[model samples]
Target: MPDIVSKSRSGTLGPAPAARTPRRHTVAVLAFPGISPFHLSVPSLVFGRIGAGGAEASPYRVVICAERPGTLSTPAGFDIVVPAGLEALDGADTVVVPSWERDMPLPEPVRAALRRAHADGARIVGLCLGAWAIAASGLADGREVTTHWSAAAELARAHPAVRVRADTLWSDDGDVITSAGVAAALDCCLHLVRKDHGSRAATELARRLVLAPHRSGSQAQYIPVAVPEALDNDPLEQAMVWARTHLDDPLDLDTWARTALMSRRTFTRRFRDRTGSSPQQWLLHQRVDHARLLLESTDDTMDRIAADTGLGTAVNLRHHFHRLLGTSPAAHRMLFRHPAA
Candidate 1:
């Protein structure tokens, strides 16, 4: 197994799996003046049901609310009518503050409501510039938080209390979670679903939404350059494809470098440029991802899974799985295994 340390700072393991009579979790997304429509829609799209029958089948009940119940303008050149007020957050299990005007002063009423919700044990999420509101409300003071990189310096200068990381896609400090901009919001929300449900459900939901099943929050929020259009013809891509299929084989950096027709030094630099991770780190993740699929779909023993995924032994598999995913293989299977299996 790889010796990589887990970057997940999120301490809370989501609410325990549903009981015999499960209650739907309530997610309250805050809407404010000049909010982004796409930002406002992320949580709803991730946690809310689509049709009338959708709510009945889904495990979460999502509601949109603002400081006052009325029409609010968005930067998208339109207005959205919010149906609820701060009271909507009173019974919420989670409160999501999406990207908002970072310079705008946090409203006293809104700040108080957020404090009350957090006092009642609600998980508070600040997506992008929403971290400004969280910080201003004193919720994120002394906590490690993150936001869109462009505004990170400003956030730090203004708050002067919270530790800000501009590189991370998201930071989950148990009750308070913050994420980088735009697409990172989607990743954060899906992570909430995965924490609440399990990998299988989150994976299926990602498929339905046409989103990547998972992107570790530790991943760099943005890649500085675009992948070349001719990437398909690159030997690096071919090498990656080959490695995915030959995971069961004992592979090393020398073999991978040779397969890519490059020296180890050149391969290392290019691989990071292309994938934003060291070769070993990327390969470790791939092996763990494959192990997840096996755990979710099959009844194979730990040793069998370990050998098949090239982790070498059952002990190695358990150590790496728990370090990366925060759960044991058996526990994961119990949460995600096919019922028939």
Candidate 2:
């Protein structure tokens, strides 16, 4: 059964406000038996202000609830005591379903509670495999959503109506939001905070949490990694880092290959193996992402941002931005721009 079976009478619910004057919102993080500690922590750490408190008004109140009250043990063999049950979904401004086992069947009471929450005008969010649970509730029917790239195939196979986007970090369809994978949950939650409280508030919160404020949802899930775990260090790390810092420079494939100490042919193969994208394509995507940050966080002119990102001309910037993100740079900035800091 489609999880989106619960009808959300409203089109979409934006994030609740954070200003002191507005009413505080209640956020319910749904937990169930044998869930991962990571899944439970993701939402709480993201929304609970788990770290030191911030200067801005609190975003919302977070409550941890289970299908039935009492003890809930994690797959890691730890137990959590909870006082609330399905009734916690009531009066929630937002309901978050963190990752659940993809194979687990949805309970009727949980589905009904989710449906009731939706009908009552609460925003519903599915993080990672939680999307599959959301699908089981029938709320995600015909919605463009994303899950962990590794599981996207299974999700699509299980629910053909879901538009599985394997490339993005998250998907926002107004009232219903879904994220790609484990860590992308952080990215999506921060995005919701940004959307609701403004970039300034989100940035401050991210700094407190030690997270990046923005990683555009449209970006590819595969990223170049060169951490120190491998005894034989990644040959491309230094080069990739250098290239990113020099996006405004005329960095052709030949230049990147030389930086990585490989011939163009060898570099092409190795770069694709590491990042799943050709150097040129990878560079283009990075430039676009950089341009987006400038558009959202600064008031730089299009031509200035273009030159900074090495798109060379405002015309080139617009073309690339539209081709990759399906929106004009001006339009994107207009939609996402936070009040000037």
Candidate 3:
């Protein structure tokens, strides 16, 4: 059995296989003028508000607050009247700044509130460009952080005091968490849910949202994609679908590149540019991801899973699995294996 660390890039790892929180916690999200509705909604949705759907009441108390108590317009040309003001931060256990539009100024009061919230020990999160607001708060000074990859250079330039990482889905530095872009915010918030609540709750919520339960920040932020010369005929997309269907068979760089009808060099470059990894790494990740699903959802033997996922042998499977996930396949299976029906 492999030892499980109490921490990972996803969040704090709980020792109990399916540990639940002992108490409910409050999550407060910040709303600001000119913010996109999508950014404002990701935290609320992932913290278990929107997809609760007859499930047990979520263990989180979610609140959305703004600088003032009134209507605010979003970039989508819509308006929403937030229910609370900055004072709402007083009771929050976690405060999320979902995103920050570059032109929108971080008002001093908002910055003060974020500082006070962190001083009071609330976990602070800045998804996407919201990291800018977190930086403006000055708490992240001298801390490693990240934002949308496109803005990473500018963020570093603007806040040289803060170390900016450009290539991650999210960064978990204890109290301050930041994510790369729009989709990565979902991963970040789900990570928080898993940390606070547990794997069971997070898995249930992920099932509802149709999201993968875990994606380490070590994965690249940008994946290379090729045009394939046809808008409707995406060779890379088609190759990915084909690869999934053929996971049980031998797969190699030349085979995958051939499936896309591109030279191996072009395929490798495009794969990295779009998916943030080379073809080999992507194939290995997909194999591990598939094997995990098999471990959780099926009673298949180790050899079966290894064979089905194209790892070729159990030793190879265990070696790659433990390398990527930090836990043995048998141990991971024990944690996530489905209960008898």
Candidate 3's TM-score reads 0.70
Q: What's the residue-level lDDT of 206 in candidate 2?
A: 89
Clashing pairs in 3: 222-276, 223-273, 223-274, 223-275, 223-276, 224-272, 224-273, 224-274, 224-275
Q: Write the per-residue lDDT of candidate 1 for residues 182-255, one digit (tens) a residue.
A: 88998888877776777667777788888987775344416574676787788989999999998888999999
- Among the numbered candidates, top lDDT falls to 1
The residue ranges of model 1 lying beyond 4 angstroms of the native Cα positions read: 1-23, 50-52, 141-146, 149-169, 216-218, 326-341
Q: What is the TM-score of candidate 2?
A: 0.83
Model 2 poorest ten-residue lDDT run: 1-10
lDDT of 2 at 119: 91
Give TM-scores for every candidate, taking all chains together and pairing residue i with residue i: 0.80, 0.83, 0.70
Compared with the true structure, what per-residue lDDT tens digits does model 3 show for residues 182-229? 889999898777656556667878888899887653435354334456
lDDT of each: 0.85, 0.83, 0.82
* Order of candidate numbers by TM-score, starting with the best: 2, 1, 3
